[model samples]
Target: MSLTKITDKAGLHRHLEAAMQLEHATIPPYLNALYSIKPGTNTEAFHILRAVAVEEMLHLTLAGNILNAVGGTPDMTVPGFVPLYPAYLPDGETDFQVDCQAFSRAAIETFLKIERPAQGATPGVDTIHKGRKRAHHNGHKRHGTALRARHVPGNEEEHFYSIGEFYQAIEEGLERLHAEMGDALFSGDPARQIGPEYYYSAGGGLMAVTDLASAKAAIRLISEQGEGVTDNIFDYEGEIAHYYRFEQLLLGRYYQKGDARGRPTGREVAVDWDAVFPIKANARIADFPEGSALRQGAEEFNRAYGDFLSLLTRAFQGEPALFVEAVGGMFQLKELYYQIMRQPLGDGTHAAPTYEIPHG
Candidate 1:
């Protein structure tokens, strides 16, 4: 795909808007899938997914930073953030599906679509591949050679590449988004740049940091913010809220008017905690009499997840600075949860697979 550059405000606006929203969109499912995994065993996949997920958080902040730099107000919590599986994308070039079906297969498909979207896939348009190299085999495409080949996964049905592929695609899309709209892309109200009220760090500040250098510094700060320093949406303001994206999958219920900041006795009142994941209680592997491998995996995940939560609570109870470490630890919970959820439903007889998001 041909790369589009942000030449005017409008172009900047559109690309960043789409980029920011999409970045936020990624965090929800990633959080759910990552958190649902049983902790610590599916080690390799865990690390990979965690890295991508965190970086995607970084991507969200980076997109927000860009919006700020361009005088755009970045809204973190917004509607349309939570999405369904095999989700549809606008301006999507390929037939590939983007979903919350959190698994290696889903992960791979997600990475592929985000990295190498079907935008600008015109004939004879050979773009150079510039990224870390892995062993290459398949199709007429040469190894180490970059071309806009159709990015179909090993599983033929999911036609996306990988996260890195999507990253590259975003770079290309930056240009396309710009060319298509020009100044209109970046032309949002500069007044929207986050101020003290909108910007919050667990213990400190995320006030508007204008200019590139300050922007990078602020990005580093918020990307590291989690739990103690500032509770994540998972444990917002000292509350255990939501059982899956504000209730889409959790009894189809929702929580509104969550308690305000510093009210930290229970889950943020804003999150709907009453909603339930039907399988969450009974689904624990330890709950089953048979004590199958799946049960063991589920139990192990629960233990680690509990520890992870404890760390966050303590981090907040003591020094918010503890949040940084909590970030990494909480990440482990996500990895573990994924492993736990991977147990196929009755030998793949399950209908409509789901990412084990414990939010509502």
Candidate 2:
């Protein structure tokens, strides 16, 4: 597939929304595995998954800041924004599948694919075009004269093979638009930006973007942390990226500095697969019987997830302080997920968070 060249502010904003959605997409599956681990067991794997999930949240905030820096509104509460489980990453890109499940070989493998590095030539193009007409999917029509790009199969000029490529295209767009629009490109209100004070407990602190340089740094942080720098598995912060961490679990060894690619020579790490609660893969609220404890627990978990999104939406809307409340919401989600895990489904399986938005 070909890359979609972004030329104007509108296209850049659309891609930023896509970026936000892509980052948000990784959290549910990660949380699914993280919460599924039995308490006091698989401690190392639990920490690893939790750390990665937190970084994904940071990536989401950075994408929102990038959108706001470019004078675009960040909306996370929109319908269909919170994807159904086993959904494709980045919404329109269907090259991979992500499933919500307990911590198992299959779940870790899915996480590995989600953070895999870009392999070939920056997956997309850098050419800019004006008035290019592209076909829309699902019988939907493009409402304006702005250039529309889709990532359907066989469309070489409108698809990206990996998340890194998608961000690279956004970076290129930012550069071009900054050259054209200069200071006006970062004209969004500074009050709307969420800074480090509001976000904590992550590997990297929040980056508030006000110009092209800061914006580029935020994008670099997200990309390198996930895909790594060039071919290396370590990010600039000297931490192993998500893919290598998951690989370490699979190889039964940790990745130490100066280790060769695909061969981790560090100390051994233990993963107790039996320690995970047997939560059904991609469990939904409807899967449980009505008025049952499992169903009620699943419903409550979904409600908390929805409230978290609501707070996040408000944070992106204008109230940056709402991020703190949203962080608290995240804590509530952890408790709720564990509560569900403690309740057995009576078939040798345990309850798990459905991750569906309540009333959505």
Candidate 3:
């Protein structure tokens, strides 16, 4: 539980990589649930999940921009970047389980937990508390914090327990580095920045980062849209944060401008749980029988998912225009996933996309 004290550029780069992974981790599970809903039914839930998933992509792009601004390459094609099913989220941190499954109450609860704010935790203002002291891998003894090497795998001891804390650490590190290096800290190519033209429907527009202020603004947008500011339910863009959106489904009600927290007094919302296709929880590619049509379709969906990731990696690498292609890939995935959901498995259930990366 010792906080990883990021002190240099290499440390920041590694943490940003973790950030990118963290953002990408939420998409598959969210997509699994979103695609499971019956078309024309649960429209509210569908829109909510779809919006959040798209914003998660925005968060990923923002993290990549930060890395690029610091002269670090954002490599999404790395091995283990696309985690296996029932994956632990916010990689290198807590053991919050996320799974690929159809839409259900359990799925919504999982989404709520993923987007929930860090309870009683203040970002950028509190000293990260360490649960225990441990020796650094380099045989150096540090007090009150842990020092870990950048980009080294299996270094779970160096991560923050919550996404907010992780970004807070990055913010602190950026401030320190900017003070030390000034304009040199943002030494990456300006042409590599991805702007609003490359991304749309991500709630707030994507901002390209060329300096410390822009970088901080991008990070803040990510945090606020996911967890909200302090205890408020709305982000700066007047949109409800992901946590509150899930809460609405749980409460079966929506929130208005004057509604109190925990008591959404807006319009009533209905969720038709029975309308969802009964996609098995944590469904895998192996679950479908071999040589079956379901298996073939699921495998094809996984391959497309892998292709989408490759395109996203290229977009982050240098070609921002590739984002349009990646977005189109997402639509193609939706079609495949829905087609799979429509197929029957000879049981009381239907086929569901396994969400595995075939080429990962």
Q: lDDT score, residue 286, model 2?
A: 78
User: Comparing candidate 1 with candidate 3, which one achieves the higher TM-score?
Assistant: 3
Ranking, TM-score, top scorer first: 2, 3, 1
For candidate 3, the TM-score is: 0.88
- Clash counts per candidate, in order, are 57, 2, 0
Model 2 compared with the native: what TM-score? 0.88
Is 1 or 2 the stronger prediction by lDDT? 2
Q: Taking the tens digit of each residue's C-alpha lDDT, what string does model 2 give over 1-360?
A: 123567778778888988887898888889889989988999999999988998999999999999998899898777657777777665234445688899999998888778866654223423222112223332432221122234434323445546776787899999999999898999899888999999877868788999999999999998888865365777667888878888899999998889976799999989999998899888878778999877887888877778788888899889999999889877777888889888777788877887777555
Q: Which ten residues in a row have the lowest lDDT in candidate 1?
A: 138-147
What's the true lDDT of residue 230 in model 3?
62
- lDDT at residue 200 of model 2 (Cα atoms): 79
- lDDT of each candidate versus the true structure: 0.40, 0.78, 0.77
Model 1 C-alpha lDDT per residue in residues 1-360, reported as the tens digit of each score: 111233445434444555554554555445554444445444444444455465555555455655655555453222333333344332122334454543333344454344331223312333333322221322222211111223323312211222223333434444465567554444434443434443233234544444444444444343333211222333333332221122212222222345332233333322222121212311323234365766556566645644544444343233335446656775575565556554555643111223222322
